[model samples]
Target: MNLSAAPAIEVQNLRRSYGDHVVLDDVSLTVPQASVYALLGPNGAGKTTLVSTLATLLHPDSGSARVAGHDVVREADAVRGAIGVTGQLSAVDDLLTGTENLRLMADLLHLPKAEGRRRASELLDRFGLADSADRTAATYSGGMTRKLDLAMTLVGGPSVIFLDEPSTGLDPRSRRELWDIVREIVADGTTILLTTQYLEEADQLADTVGVLDGGRIVAEGTPAELKRRVPGGHVRVGVADAVELDAATRVFPDAVRDDATLSARIPSADDLVSVRDVLGRLEDAGITSASVTVETPDLDEVFLSLTQPAAPSRTASTAKELS
Candidate 1:
């Protein structure tokens, strides 16, 4: 709902190829300022390739990427200055302390020594690394290293950030911690372009999620919208007695019944009318279910439905083979 038309990132008709392999074809998405956009895909789906091109780390055969109002290709310096990138792997150096790693970034940005030290100290505290600021990165735990790596990326105070699987190797707690950090960043009005193989991560963090399958966005929308597109949502009703269960099943033959739970899982009608109609019949028949709850397909369910089946309309992979 916060998707403003004021675009923070504009990518149009992007195309890229690897040697003779086509990776992205006619891909386009506009990210609103201060929103989180997640790029999700399985292996070889071009999620990495797309983010790399957008980050200006790799060149696209054709198409333009505009980040924070600067061209990624023509104005690479401006683009870099406006954005921060935390790649799939931790970029922390074992020899450096947490504060030193952040200082390295400040030095690269050419901040005044006083400003650099000031920013470093602030980021260390902001990222919850104040206790370990003096410890060598080599001695940091996995979560600590990741926190330090992320802190280093924020040293320059870039307005937009690119996070590619920031939580990939982290434990659940660490991942949750990273998620909290991401939320805090976005809350402060920084737009994010996130690439992750973890569907749950996308579900949890993305305001707008795009599914890249074989190099194209096969599906794109809010998490709930995408899940709603996939079928198989249902409402399960628990019947009070065996006689009521039999009557309910007779009314709806497609319902899956379980005698043990005294419940029947019926296909959802997606409307209150159908529910009221069914209940009216049950009431007339003197039958009742103990309770009912609507269950909808989740992100994992929707991802499998869109990506597992090879759709013929995919232009990216086909163009790659023929390129």
Candidate 2:
């Protein structure tokens, strides 16, 4: 959040092209340390390209990016040393046991043998894989496999992590479970740059959100700030009959009246004070509404409004495409 401090991830006018097609065009962003920054785009709005570029998996055609204070292109080794990446698919070996997977990561990190064993044990317990530590990943549930994959990523104690659609095919329960794990990771001061298609996931986790579309970042802000930009919040009041409906409309002159449902859709921010204020006015006017429902502009609405006409679509293959 502090502008003066070096960002965990920073990019300026980043451009990437494949053959004759542009995959990323003048993309720029900054992710603060110890915060979760979500890059939201439909299926293929160049989210993967952006992440891969930041992770030093791909070099930009122009501009510059830094990860953990190291230039992604110039100091790629340092950037790699400070970051971890979990792509859409589980990277764990199906034949390897849970403990073996973590051990493999530890070995790749070049940790001492004794330290590798200790780290693997800790990760198995931390990710709730202790009971299944000896079980082959082939027999693990979808959620378990994901946890192990993420645990493997953390074996090196990275300062920044990149997650590309971490919850792609997960069930709702599994997704929520992964969300909790993500929260815990951030709480530990590991900055994360996550690319996800789930609007709710970004809404729930991001300290800042960048909406990417057609290889460009169209919007950027906190979840609440983005929602406020699109005017959609309202309160709907249902009344008994024409008389009550008429009374409601008179009280709320700008309300959109519904004759069939005997309801009035009143323009409101859908906050507590606003809801109470509306109800108080209706009460003062001696108008009784049979039911009241509050609705607000969510990420879905903002996403649709911003990435439209040219909705998120797959572009040509980048240096590393998520298959």
Top-lDDT structure, candidate number? 2
Question: Model 1, poorest ten-residue lDDT window?
Answer: 314-323
lDDT of candidate 1 over 76-102, digit per residue (tens) = 889888888886745688999998999
* Tens digits of per-residue lDDT for model 2, 1-323: 65448889989999998987787978889998999999998875789888888888888999999889989999999999999999673579999999899888888889999999999999888888899999999999988898899998899999999999998889999899899999999999999999998899999999999988767777888997677666586788888889988888998897899999889888763333266777788888887555777666888988887774443344423212311
- List clash counts for every candidate, in order: 1, 0
Candidate with maximal TM-score: 1
Candidate 2 clashes between residue pairs 3 or more apart in a chain or in different chains: none
- Candidate 1: Cα lDDT at 11: 92
TM-score of each: 0.80, 0.79
